[model samples]
Target: MIRFALILTSLLGLGITCQAADKQDLSLLTRTAEQFARRQLADSDAKITARKLDPNLSLPACDSLEAYLPPNGRLSGRSTVGVRCARDGWSINVTLDIQLFSQAVVASRAIRAGEVIQATDVQLQRVEIGQLPSPPLGSIDQALGKTPVVGIGQGIPLRADMLRAPAVIQPGQSVRILVNGDGFQVSGEGKALGQAALGQSVSIRTNNGQVVTGVVTGVGQVTVTP
Candidate 1:
């Protein structure tokens, strides 16, 4: 009787082990994670590496597995992927690393602050732009006529915040002013009291000495309405 009981217990344990192993396929989980990461960065060139789920980690037999990213998660470099069983409602996080690459505008040579960017100053290169806060400029045309707010190193990627827009109207410069009503148009001349970029507001001191705020519409021009 004792021998029979021991043999039955060993068989039952072996069966349970096999059943557990079949419950989850670790390889499938890793692949799901990789696919999810790739989709998130489909617009850019990215290479992803996902760590395999641990063999010893036990999960319920999931009928449908879905992968997701965490809120505010960084898409480049080391990141986490969350996988959930759609049917069972159990979720787990997996580790993943992504190397993001894109063709972006970079300084071909060192540029100084306040220097007007020329066609030869910037060029596009396929470079690793890991977790950039701002998207890099992708073309020389986008960088042309823009001056750096600060000195930038050669080969460094160019972003919007790094450059300042060329002011269309400078302080104390003569500016053509236009005043528009419901239908009719009026025009005058004023001295620009402040510097402004295109589409930015600037104070215009009219020839009559009354200051009016207007938007910079073009070089040496501001527009206002009475």
Candidate 2:
């Protein structure tokens, strides 16, 4: 009977050791998630944070933990991160809250319609990328010399669709038209039939009474390939 008791005690001790090894600490999983997020999203401007796991939530400690995103998954906005153990066939999906922040150009003051944007007309502000109604303008260079399509309020974020290149050549004005051929280039005076911005298309009536469409290359200048 003594030999039987010794065998039973040895079996019980082994079972306890296996159970302890199989149980994983929650802290390990959270730390792994945080590290994975920062590495994968290193190129992005947004900050990444891993939420705490529930203390009551029980999970087997995985021998190997693999973190991955679902197919067609994005790092922005609401996303899910999957942590799985291939050997144990157990996995956990952690819901992540992603916030994207970026710097954008905003109007420095009230800007009137058709007013040309200047260096002092705009400033940069840090804002959430997803909240903008349109694509945010990132630099003063993009807004400089561009005219607003409509009046804009002070402190409002500037968008590309909100502004445009000011009309440099107006209708009823005289323009120099350049015609380029295989071997030569010729210049002629023409009357513009429509207003045009830089690099925009304009219709011009040459002095010879020929109406031709050309690309506006500069102020009061249009170019045509003949």
Candidate 3:
């Protein structure tokens, strides 16, 4: 009787060990599914849920340890039979794509594909949309064109040969001059001879035949001295 009781107890312990191993395998499957869902489907602030498939529906066959055992019938006892967990692992499979948007205003005008766009360009477009004021026209260079000419006096007769034509002057013109007994002075008036652009050098002849060279500064001004 004592030997029989001991044998029964040993069998019970073996059964408990087998049940624990099965539970561990099931837990592993659940964890793997969760990881897949987190990585593929709900990466953003979006929500995600999953469902397992039923075991009766085309479950994978689990391998039995007996297949590897010798014909002598010694049991290896390794088995692979299992229930289908969560769509058999299909619910965790997912794909994600992200899109971005800008808050900046765009031009109402038609935009060509592949054209590089900038903030200033967008602002100009917005002007057409009447979302913002029209950009100011005629940059400083344009304003300089409309500038008036300054006058030179004190009987300092301009040199006819050196007399840079007044037409050479434009708004905001300047020039350098070596005056009669006055040393060097830069002077010129509007457009440095009207409509003259910046950086153009012209010859100015003083009353005493002194030749001076200068750049247009304003509509009627030129710096001749320096």
C-alpha local distance difference test of each model: 0.90, 0.85, 0.34
The Cα error of candidate 3 at residue 61, in Å, is 13
The candidate that achieves the highest TM-score relative to the unseen native structure: 1
Off-target runs (Cα >4 Å) in candidate 2 are: 1-30, 52-58, 130-135, 208-211
lDDT tens digits by residue: candidate 3, 43-162: 333232323433333323232211111234211122112223332342212121222111223322333333333322222111121112232221222212121223322221111121
Error of 2 at 186 (Å): 2.5
Please give the clash total of every predicted structure, in order: 0, 0, 74
User: Sorted by TM-score, highest first, which candidate order results?
Assistant: 1, 2, 3
- The total of clashing pairs for model 3 equals 74
Q: Which candidate is the best by lDDT?
A: 1
Which run of 10 residues does model 1 get worst, by summed lDDT? 20-29
Better lDDT candidate (1, 2): 1
Tell me the TM-score of model 2: 0.74
Q: Model 2: how far is 192 from its true place, Å? A: 2.6
Q: Estimate each model's TM-score.
A: 0.84, 0.74, 0.22
After superposition, which runs of candidate 3 have C-alpha atoms over 4 Å from their true positions?
A: 19-24, 52-226
